[model samples]
Target: MKKFMNFGVLALLGMALTFGMTSCSDDDPDYSNVTPPTVELAKANISGMVTTIGGKPIAGAEVTAKLGSTTLSATTNADGEYTLEGLAENGTYTMTATASGKQSVTGSVTVNKGETAAWNTRLSNEATTVSVSQTEETSVEVVTETLENNEEARVTTVTVIPAAAVEEGEEIIVTPVYSTDYATTKAATTKDFMLMGINISCSNPNAVLKAPIKLTFDLTDDVIAQIKPMKEVNGSWVEAEVTEEGEKVVFTVDAFTTYSLFINATLNQNASTEAISFAQAEYDNLYGASEMSVGTATYTYKMGSEIGQHSNLLGAYLAEILAQQMAGSTVKTVNGSYEINVTLPIGTALTLSGKQAVETTSIAAGSTTVSGKSYGKVSVTANTYNRQHNGGTN
Candidate 1:
């Protein structure tokens, strides 16, 4: 038996949202003496249709919506439609669609007031389309160059480090089954609506082995500001340490599991922000200055403004640039372990070494918590558990 860590993407949207729209008339109202209304930021809903190049709905396609900095993702239903919540109704947004064998498509949409927008997108399998094949050559040397940002006094870099390949005659199998069942039990509502997950799988199963994969990133000053390296689990980012050799960030695994990158960022601001924890909604409210919003974070005036969540995001996987890195990902095998090295932002480097594993009964059925250790939220489906295997046989 062997122990191998799994890597995967978990697009989560636990927060529910509701929005509505009202059309204004051409008539103008006199407000020379009327006081302006206050603004309260709130979450909005975004949804759309997805189809194949042949006009067929694309079920299970990965769909992600990004506004300014924050991003949310979900899978399409049987109707080839997806709905992403926990988004602020304060700005314009873009959505990306990805499927197993189709060319991915990206489009923009808007969410206003309490009103959600409807967008339609299509994926193609045409010759011009690029397939996201998991297996690509992984051996190449790397060199890097840096770029600078004047506003933030920061520098960006694009590094090209190629990982070694597996020895000849090794069987290659790639499975997408990856998970770790860790959930929040303290509160269902505050169950941490932030983060994404990825399941790592390979040709060998249930064995004590390591899967090595690398990411090639075009680092920018803004991206490095909010970067975190870890696996999201039970309301936590399980840190996995990576070394920065030149332009690459490297990781080594020894068991089946899910992985993530947690980015903590703020929304784009128009006016200078106050110490106040709210966004400045740029329009007028349905009511005068005295009108207050309840059970909602949004004021009618806050529609179409600058705003975002006040927490770290578990959402890098939804970005096209992130996916592009994997397109060039490579891995090599030695004995029973895989070697993976990638060029990406080192954000806040982390590690899983010396961390204690939870010894529990069966995994808590679904996304639920037990005692202080949550399970089922992050899961790995593998042939062998690392605790039982001895890191593959000689």
Candidate 2:
């Protein structure tokens, strides 16, 4: 008898996906204005067989694939097959294959340059009981029920979520300007600026089954401006304004990095929620930053059409570094604002480092709670080859 295990969406898996980026130095200057290598193309092939506890192929089962950094979908065919094409790089790829009830799976794959690889998966029996569990910046574990015949065909799946989710809110980008000469006079804003539509992923398969997620902001930018500052000019306090002349300023914001989705997993006969929670917490504390900063955010900024294309979040950080690298640069301070962005060396990495905590094992065993922390160092590196060719050399 073939045992059956139905792990819900495999969101809490702690898999490491490394992005190999080469950094450039100003000393090794090219000066040519070269265009950095943008995502030229991207593609995906999703093929999977749908089966029941009774061992029969179910036609027309839905299987969708998400391309690098985007939430768009490419679904499977009537023959239980699917594929996503037109991806650019031959880097690490994250995929989620799903069909109703049959445990959904999310995993990472390496797609070689111009290569059309095959992604074949098998769907298991539908889940009997809906349950949920979570681990902070670590990993999420989910187990499924055994086959009716008492065979052990259980599946425990884990997926890595961004560390930011566990901490507070989705990651935000802020821009502040500084004077080329006087770096101490912090710049000021007259109005409250808004950078909206920030989206975060829930890496816990069980999270979706539990409750909707919420992230609050609490970030400070010692380099740029977070909250604008003002002083009493003529007996009345008013916001300071930035004239054509530059002023030094710092900025920052904090928010939830997870989504409104929930996860629900059950404790099947073969699997324990305790084991899963522990594994996830450890993983988050170890590599959550790397996966999000390097894996998800970097990938999105480099490829996606949303915020990545408009705001040079990475580019802005690079610009700050560039300012820092110049001779005789200094930082400015604001009176009322807490967070700010300071000028830093161009092409220098903005290390994003932090940590997360494990929620509770009790939640997995029928309780209604999930928790954890998300921490790490998020640094941005400039494209060396592109800078050499484009930054004036060309």
User: Number of the top candidate by lDDT?
Assistant: 1
lDDT of each model, Cα atoms only?
0.34, 0.27
Best by TM-score: 1
- Report the error of model 2 at residue 218, Å: 54
Model 2 misplaced stretches (Cα beyond 4 Å): 1-68, 130-394
Report the lDDT of model 1 for residue 208: 34
- Per-residue lDDT for 1-394 in model 1, tens only? 1222222111122121111112232354443333322222224566555665223566999988887778889998776766676565457788788898765766676665433444455554422111223355332221211011111211122211122223333332321111112222211222112222233333344433323555332234334334455543446446677555554344443343444433332211122211111122121232344333222222111111111111111222112112121111111110110111211111111111111112121111122211111111111111111222212110
Worst lDDT 10-window in candidate 1 = 373-382
For model 2, residues 152-245, the per-residue Cα lDDT tens digits are 2222232223333332332221111121111222223312221111222333422221232222222223213323333222233334332111
Per-candidate TM-score against the hidden true structure: 0.27, 0.23
Query: After superposition, which runs of candidate 1 have C-alpha atoms over 4 Å from their true positions?
Result: 1-48, 51-198, 210-218, 232-236, 266-394
